[model samples]
Target: MKFTEGMWRLREGIRIDWMNNVERLRVENENVELLLNKFQRHRGDTLNSATVTASVTSPLEGIIGVKLVHWAGQVDNGPHYQLASSSGHTKINHEKTETLSYDSGALNLAINTAPNELDFVFSGAKGKLTGHSWRSIGYVGDQTTEKSQWDDGIFFERQGYMLAALDLGVGEKLYGLGERFGPLVKNGQTVDIWNEDGGTSSELAYKNIPFYVSSKGYGVFVNHPGKVSFELQSERTTRVNISVPGEELEYFIIYGETLKEVISRYTALTGRPSLVPSWSYNLWLTTSFTTNYDEQTVTGFLDGFRDRDIPLGVFHFDSFWMKSYQWCDFEFDEELFPDAGGYLKRLRERDLKISVWINPYVGQASPLFQEGKKNGYFIKRTDGSVWQWDLWQAGMAVVDFTNPDACTWFSNHMQRLMDLGVDTFKTDFAERIPYKNIQYHDGSDPARMHNYYTLLFNKVVYEAMISRYGKSNSLLFARSSCPGGQVYPVHWGGDCESTYEAMAESLRGGLSLMLSGYIFWASDIGGFEGTPPPALYKRWVQFGLLSSHSRLHGSSSFRVPWIYGEDCSDVLRDCVKRKILLTPYLLAEALAGYNEGTPVMRPMFLEFPEDLNTYPLDTQYMFGSNLLVAPVFTDEGTVTFYVPHTPEDSQGKWVSWFDHSKTYEPGQWYTETHGFDTLPILIRPGSVTPINPKLKAPQDDALNGLEVLVNGSLANDMAVQVVNPSKTHNVLKVIKIESQSGNVTADDAGVKVVRIGH
Candidate 1:
């Protein structure tokens, strides 16, 4: 994706025709065609012919979309993110002589038709709104007209870009672009918005969203689902440049007073996350990958936890629960789970829910394969051959989510599973949908559907679950997703290794995805790939249990605590208890996420945008707005975090929830070390944090006492949304409390707790 070498030359076969002047401009309906020249004077210059077309489409109110196209007539059906929020098209009046202007959402686009200049002046906070330059236009190579180009181009997408390289001060950093594990601040690296299966080590990401938040207080979302390459002061030392191949490049320039506001507006435009059940936040045990387990093994694990007084809420059966190479058969491996239905009933009797792992692949060995093939449920080539591959399973064919019948056929199996007490689904493998030479029943462009396919696939399964169960009761341990996939509830960092580095990288990825509007995120506790050291397992357990959805899963090993050591049970028990106690507070934050489109787990910038020190600090994140969680990634059990010294109002008081530790002043950096038994969870001034003392299952009544922790100098007020015990995500009560003295009065109106000293 890089076209330039260093600061001067082009890299190898890269040819960039930087447009200097717009020689000729033609307007036809909603399209504007431009003929450009690299130098100045040009009548019919064939040096680098770039014909650019800008199609104006408003997908949502207060937003204008100008999709720039370079090559015409290569409209292929492929994978593309579906933008569903465009509306209210105001008439665009063009001034004579090609000088045209249109305004929307305080953004003014002034076009100098003759000079081929398109300037977007965002009327941001005072004079802080940014603008795009002239050299930002121009498309990449031609789109292939060949029929087989769909699958090959899944890794790439067409784009249009305008770039600026601003200096990152001596300590300037970046954060927020949907759960990334690279540098939290993307100032010194090159990033690509392409989803991959690479674990949290290299730059490759499983959920590569085309968005980034800079510490400089602005976010740029390249509105493309394919591949978008960003050089964050990497190639150009002074600027961040993004390049996408194709006839069109579209990105948004968002500005706000703080990074949180930027997220507010971004999620408003993309999609807000949903509120998951309170129990979903509790500890989840899984039959880890490659581990031998049956009903007896599962019962033994459950019994061990019960004997230890560890409350296990959800039990997930990994891929092996189904017959080998017969994935998605929707039939539990009878050899292993002889009575899946009866076992589920037993789990329900124990007040535990069950979840199963499934992908969209329809293996030939699966009984549903023939039904899908006969009913056109799978994607097919132009030759009418079902697209089959042996990557994960033998003759695995992808279900054509674009086909209504295919979705119905797939949903039916899940619906039946629900009838048998399957509560949730781990919707996996959506990132690997085959695009090339495949045909969708809806006649969708295959290339545009690769990334978008994840949405429909998840939606089909998610909707079926919701319809059969209830909306509030629906959840998915989904792996792959696009922009709007936030509609699904919970997602985990896919396929992590058993190591501290991978654990840290998983945190980075989760933080990045959280920025991209995902409300919930979890990773395999103690990693998913290799056998983790006991130290690593204990550390990962603390981190995972603290997350929105905690699950102990692995690829080739069992994640039962005793397998690591007897001490491991103590670690898991401690974290699980803390999570249960904090469920009252976490669920309230989730409700706010439902309303605000923000993440319960947030990067540093989302909390303190003005504090440049926290921008690149991805090692630590805020569980909600109040508490800061810095996961220990080393054997030393040491964590280094920066707390924005906020000036206390009238009363100077800051308290630590773990221990009523000390009072710290505002506006300074603190390097506080913690033991494996604790992490830095600072409570802000004038905040109320809710803790359920009952500490039963997450869904148990939270109305009694509801020990609201009042951390130092509580000035303003705080609120807690009392979760309904009977119904998931339903608020039985919204308590607004004000704490000044020993007595606390519940505010007449509701409030969200801010227990941290910010």
Candidate 2:
């Protein structure tokens, strides 16, 4: 994707035609069109050169889109991200002699139309955000050379690419390129927005979204389904270079007053995350992959949890539930469980929901494979044969989701599992799609469908679950995702190692995904690759139980807490009980994520954007708007975290949630050692956190024993809304508390209130 050798020269066989000057500009009803050509000194200089056409329009009130086309004749086949747009009005001002401006809400795009000055500057009410200037827009071509090799091992006569570079200001950092694991900040990195099945310790990502929010109160979304390569200050040091294949490239500039507002506008254009069921917020135990497990093993795991006094919510069956080499058949191995339906019914009687693993693949050994191959339900080659690969399964063929019959065929199989009392699905492995020499039934571009296949794969399964269960009950533990995939809730970090480094990497990935508009995220509890040490397992349990969703899954080994030690089970029970008590506060944060695009596990910068210290701190995060959670990554239980200062706090102080008497000054770093049961969970000043002390499960009535923990002094009156566990956006009751002479008093007579840091 890199075309330049340095600043002065291009690489071999590379040709770039940059947009130099605007020859003509036309405005029609808030839409601006520009006909740009290369730098011309005379009339005959424009005879044989190519011209670029640019269109600018407002999709929503606070967003502006720009589409640049090198060749306008290519047909846009299909497989586009579903985006929502409003018919927002904009103001056009071309009367000025030097600049032509378009205003959408408070965001303004001013184009310098002075003779040879072709610059596009985006500004807000505060100041300028970012812009494009000289040599920023170009059409690149790679002619065949000795070393010219394209992505798919095929060399073309001339491959075309369109690129645009935006300015990166001093001290500005970029974040959220979709579940990245390298670092929180994306500067000085070469990121390719292509989905892969790579694990958490590399630069490759399972989810690759082409949207990034900046520290300058703005964000940019590249609207391309295929691979979009970004050189974030890596190539040119002061620019974000984005290049995509084919004839056209489109991008949107979203502006907001804060980082959270930028995410709100971005998700409004794509889709909001759906609210999951309350029981899903509790603990989930799964059969480890590649481990020898029958009904007895699963039963023993469940019994162990109950005997240890730990609350269990759901039980999941991994891939071995099906026969070997016959996935997507959706049948339990009769050898393993002779009475599959009866066993599921018995588990359901235990007040537990069931989840099963499934993927969009049909091995040749499966009976459905022959049925699909004959009915044209699988992806086919150009010769009309079903495409086959022997990677994960023998002779595995991908289900063609482009055909409506194929989708129905796949969903019917899932419904069979649902009929057996299966409550949800763990949709896995859509990232290894074959993009070469294969064709979709709908004739979508193969490279584009590679990343988009995850959406179709999850959408089919999610809709099937919604048909069986209601909206609030349907959930998917998905792995791969794209731009519009946030509508399906609860994705997890895939295939991490069993080490402390991987645990921190998983947190970084989850925080990155949350910033990308995803609401709920989880990771493999004790890691997925190896046997975790007892200290590592106990530490991970505390971190995992505090996440939006918690699951214990691994490969080749069991993830039962007692396998480590007896102390591990006790630590896990303590964490699970604490999470059950904190359900009222967690559900309220989830409602904010469902209504707006606020993340439940958000980075520190999202809350304190004014503090410079919060931008570089990815080791800790805000669990909600009020509480800060710093997970203990070290086995020794020593953790150092920073408490941020905000303008609203009269006395800059934060109170510890574990011990109410312990307080810390803001804008200072503190290091503390904790046992297996505690970490640094700090409550923000002047905030009310609701807790249900008597709840046994997350689905219990929150109003039964609700108590509001008031931190520091309340300067103003506030109301705490206790969300209903069974319904979405339903608030059971509001507890109004007034600040009387710096003392907190609740209006509801029966509600108990506790004041901290008095």
Candidate 3:
């Protein structure tokens, strides 16, 4: 994807034709088109050779979309991100001359019809936001001429690449390249927007969304579902370069004064994340992968949580549910689970939801594989053979989600499981889709369908759940996703090591996911590959329980608290209870994510945009808009974090939710030591935090006996919405607690209001 060598020369066989001048400009209906000619001297020189036709239009109120085309006609097979709403012919006010100016909302785009440049400057109510200059547009041609063709002039096969580079201002940082695990600030990094099954330890991401938000209060989303290679300050050092493999590349520029508004607009174009069921927020216990487990194993895991006094919500059955070498057979292993339905029924009677594992693959040993191959339900190769690979399963053939019959065939299998008391499916491994020399049944481009496959795969399963169990109860524990895949409720971080570093990286990945518009995210509590040490296990328990969704899963070892130590059980119990108590606040945040595209686990910059220090602080995040959670990553149970002091921040003192004696001032770094039972969860000043003591399940009706704990000084009116116990409705509760000279006066609606600090 890198085209240049160092700062000067092109690498190997790379050729770049930078559009330098615009020959003609005109407006047709809702689009503005420009006929761009490469460096030309005389009028006759612009007659032939390759030229770029650039079209500019407004897709949303404050979003401007630009598409650059090199070839006139090219077959576009299908697969594009689905936009939630249409722009519907937005009014464009233009002033024509040698230099034409067009304005949409507060976004002003100036086109130099004579020179080769397109500039976008946005001025909102908060003044100048961000701009993309013309020097960033590029049409690259990569070709290698044979030695014989050099003299004969016969070789002309050149791969077309369209690249768009936007200006990166001083001190500007980029975030959200779809659940990245490295540093949060995406500067000096070359990111390829291609989905892969790489674990959370590397630069390769399972969910590579073609979208990013800048600290300068704007976002750019590439419309291409295929690979989008981005050079974030790595290629040009001052500009973020985006390259797509086609003659035409389309992208949208969204404007907002704050990162939250940028996310709102971005999610509005793509879809907003749907609300997950309330019970999903509770603790989930899973049968560890590759571990010997059956009905007795599952029963023991559930009973272990209950015996340890841990509040359990959902129980997940990993890949071993089906017979080996026959994934997607959708049948319980007769040797292990003889009575799958009866066992699941008994678990449901205990008020615990059941989730089973599934993937869009049918191994050759599977009974359904021959049927799928004969019915043309699997992806086919160029030679018309069914695509088969032996990576995860023996001769596993991927389901062709592009085919309607194939989707129905797959969904019917999942629907049958749901009918047998299964509440959810942990849809996994859609990231390993084939793209080379493969064809989709519906004629979708293989490259585009690679990442978009998850969108369809999860959609089929999610809709099946919605059909079986209404919209309020539908959920999928999905793994891979793309731009619009946030519509599905829950996605967890993929395989991770059982170490403190992996735990921290998981948090980093989850935080990055929030920036990418994903609402609820989870990971293996003590990592996925190996069993975590006792210290790391206890620490991960606190962090995992605080996450939007919590699950205990591992590969070779059981994640039962007793496996780690007796102290781990106490830690798990304490963290689960604390998270359950904080359910009212967390559910309110989840509702906001569903309705307004605001992420429940937010990066610090989203809450305090003006504070420059918050840009690179990925170690900590705002759980909702008030509580700051900084997970301890070391064995000593120590953490170092910063509390930003900005005008928009709460105007009172910072209060530690743990020991009331341990309080800190804002705008400073704080290092604190915690025991296995304590984690640093700081509440912002002037915030009203709602809590539910004696918490049970997520559907427990705690609203009738809710406790509104006033954190710091409730200097302003605060409100929190708690979902009804029946999971039917969200009840909005408002409290006005004015901060007097030193005392606070509260207006309570029969709910206990307790102040946190003196």
Specify the highest-lDDT model's number. Answer: 2
User: Which should have the higher lDDT, number 1 or number 2?
Assistant: 2
For candidate 1, the lDDT comes to 0.72
Instruction: Choose 1 or 2, whichever is better by TM-score.
Output: 2
Total clashes in model 3, counting residue pairs 3 or more apart in sequence or in different chains: 0
List model 3 lDDT by residue over 1-758, tens digit each.
Answer: 67888767887888787776777778877788987767677778776567788898887777888888988699989787877545563665555545666566766666665454545555456555555565556678777633223444655566778977777777888999899999888999999999999999999999999889988778888999999999999988878888998898998888876778889888889998888777888888888789999887778877888887888888989999999999989998988988888988999999989999999999999999999999999999989999998999999999998889998998888888988999999999899999999988889999888889999999999999988998788889988999988898799999999998898888889988899878789989999998789999988998898889999999999899988888889899889888888888887778778777888888898998777788889889899888888999999977999988746344566778876666777789988888887777887776777778856766777665677666664444555566654452355555444555222234465677777754
Which window of 10 residues has the lowest lDDT sum in candidate 3?
A: 738-747
**Model 1 / residue 137 / CA error / Å:** 1.1
Deviating ranges (above 4 Å) for candidate 3: 6-8, 85-93, 116-135, 145-155, 646-651, 732-748
Error of 2 at 176 (Å): 0.4
> Per-residue CA lDDT of candidate 1, range 1-758, in tens?
55567767765534555655555555554434445545445555645455555554444433445565555576756555555564444435576555656555544445565554544343433443444455555444323323225566665432333333223334445555555777665677888776666767788776767777665566667787766778777776655677765556777655556666666667777777766666688788999878888999999999999998888999998888999878889999999888889989999999898999899997899988888889888889978989999988999999988888888888989988998999999888877777677778888867667767778888898899889777778888888877877888688888888888888888888888887778889999999999999989999988898788899999888888888888888988888998898877887888878877778888766776556566667788888877777788887776766666444443545556676656555455566666667777677665667777676878787766477666655455545577675565578776666555523454432232334433
On TM-score, the leading prediction is: 2
Return the lDDT, model 1, position 114.
51
Instruction: Report the lDDT of model 1 for residue 700.
Output: 80
Q: How many residue pairs clash per model?
A: 48, 0, 0
Question: Model 2 off-target regions past 4 Å?
Answer: 145-157, 741-747
TM-score of the candidate numbered 3? 0.96
